[model samples]
Target: MKWLWMTGLVCALFASVQAQPQPLPAEVQKRIDAIFDGVVDRWIVQMDRWWHDGQHEHLINMTYFAIMLDPHNISLYENAGWLLWSSDRDDEAVALYQRGLRNNPDVYDMYYELGQYYYIRKRDYAKAREYLEQAIKFPCEWFVWNTLGHVYARLGEREKAVETWQELLRRFPMMPVDQMEAVRKNIRDTMTRDTTPTAGENTQQ
Candidate 1:
């Protein structure tokens, strides 16, 4: 069944490539896109089944195929890398992330994922900080800021960590009250532990 599906995908992709020299009619293009989307959706379903059944190798193969079909799908890269990491294919996961960064140079999430891999898996604080810092240069999620702060703290840069958390609060003012308070508590705790500088003290200088 898997071989049949892969054969169909290969044939479809080959046909599409052969037809690429000529401009496809709008209606024909729409139908082609619909068919392609259907194939991808079915593949996703199969991948999910494989994942649940502990068929890690099969899932990883399908993930690689999915990336080949749609390299721009950021979620695919993230999920595939995570799967590899969880399966103890750590080198493959890092390589997959590097490939993702190559395909998506400007995406913040790729950097964030790499940062997380370094921080959590390798305990490489400097590398984590490097990637997390790059992640913040673009529009990113709240956790990026939070994790970067943690990285700074691990690196013994308590002041920078507090500032990072403070900046997170400033940027996401409408966040949930509990989350907001948690961040404030982190700031307070860090301040109490280290009296070197306040959150914005160094920035003022």
Candidate 2:
């Protein structure tokens, strides 16, 4: 993911260079250098530092400033929202992801990440299912389906969970056999657990 940010910076550098006039005005060049050095590089460093030290506040602020500098770079929005999430500012994180989606509706990762917050932390299975459904409509990884199945299970929708994992196998035929085996085991376990009588029912019988 950091590589995505680096690639964005490289593209920006190239675009700035190519857009320069033949004369390459001194002020324009200086501004470009300043943007790369002060904003882009600094943001990259802040993100790396956050990963190393768990410094979410500084990372979130720096990522926000980076977004201001390059609103078109979708990765900046993702990183900023993720920073807020890592800080446990979940509502703010969701809002930031929603804002990014408003600007770039095609970025499906926004939905996936937002859904992850609800599913993993808040236990808001409805919201998780909502956003994960949106995410699967577009191009995303297999894990989205896996998580959606978990959300379904959490809501006691075991049938839906089994179907969802089957769908994952259908959608990604090349997925590793071990992962598929895990899903199959999960489905079997859920079904068996459901059919098993409770201790109270056993006593009554």
Candidate 3:
């Protein structure tokens, strides 16, 4: 009876301690929580500071907080990755997108951004194609097909571009009207720009 009573007391104490709000560390957690407190209101202030002082690390920390505060908000992850990418942190941006996907696999748009990041920023076209393919697996995302078409066009895969456009048309007969002319414009632009210039023009004589 005595041993059982002691075990119960210990379990209750452990539960109480676990229930208490933790004193978040100063390194990133404290700062992030502070951002949660008023970070959105002063978001512009923090951004301006990043621009003026070139303190991207701080900005990254704040973004971490924003994401933590609204765990369900996929846009927070998008904004964090976008800012990091714009600031020339391609590796960090990639990691952020990967982490975001782990948390919110339903956020299809991150795949699009990750694809663009791979193609444009990292110059890893193969990885870009992989991500864009994943993005297209999601629903009602004709825009994703448009992006894939551009990627294939840039890669000089004419067959892929044609197939992409065909898929877009098949999905949306009024595709141009439905997607604000983006898919139609890509189809037209890729088909138009695909001309094999004269051999003389191809090689600067």
Candidate 4:
């Protein structure tokens, strides 16, 4: 992902090198290479700041320009979508994520990040659960499992949520005691709840 811009530049150069019957003149190719290198250098500087500071707007703009330079770069779409989503531009972000999926269906991070957006930002529990499930098929992260359990709990799938949390604790026994206790408490609470009380009612109890 860090080399996304360079990947774009390299692919362009490779395609230029593979050109059919005739290649570009040496001087013309040299000038094009220099121009591309300059653009990539600028992008690298901008992306460095983006990584350190959360300049989502600048990152998104750079990604758009990079995509225009190399449409085949899948990572550009992923990062751009992430930036847009982080900036609260949900519709455009979703469209970009879908576009990235269309281009490379195996990009599981897109699913994971999209699931996070739905879960944490949109509060769309069903969609979050679906995408997180898809993401787990590729790679299972601890936080994903944790969030998946929360999603199940929110959906009133008490047993499933309990099982999910139990599985996590079993798999990662060294997890902090307080965290494990919290999971256990959630399970116990869910098991004991006979009525679907309102938040205020639960709080008052």
TM-scores, one per candidate: 0.84, 0.69, 0.61, 0.64
> Which ranges in model 3 have alpha carbons more than 4 Å from their true place?
1-59, 173-182, 185-205
lDDT of 3 by residue, 1-205 (tens): 6533533554454455446687545675555545445634455466557747877666666666555445555666676687788888878888988888787677577788788788667766678889899888887466677767766766777678868877987886765574646566656655777463222331100
C-alpha lDDT values of all predictions: 0.81, 0.73, 0.66, 0.70
In model 1, what are the clashing residue pairs, if there are any? none
Tens digit per residue, CA lDDT, model 2, 29-51: 78776766665666677677786
lDDT of 1: 0.81
Candidate 1 vs candidate 2: which has greater lDDT?
Answer: 1
TM-score for candidate 2, residues paired by index: 0.69
Q: Write the per-residue lDDT of candidate 1 for residues 7-60, one digit (tens) a residue.
A: 466657756665698878899878777866777777788888887998878777
Off by over 4 Å in 2: 1-42, 72-75, 195-205
- For model 1, give the 10-residue run with minimal summed lDDT: 196-205
Whose TM-score is higher: candidate 2's or candidate 3's?
2
Error of 3 at 110 (Å): 1.8
Winner on TM-score (1 vs 3): 1
Against the true structure, candidate 1 reaches a TM-score of 0.84
* lDDT order of candidates, top first: 1, 2, 4, 3
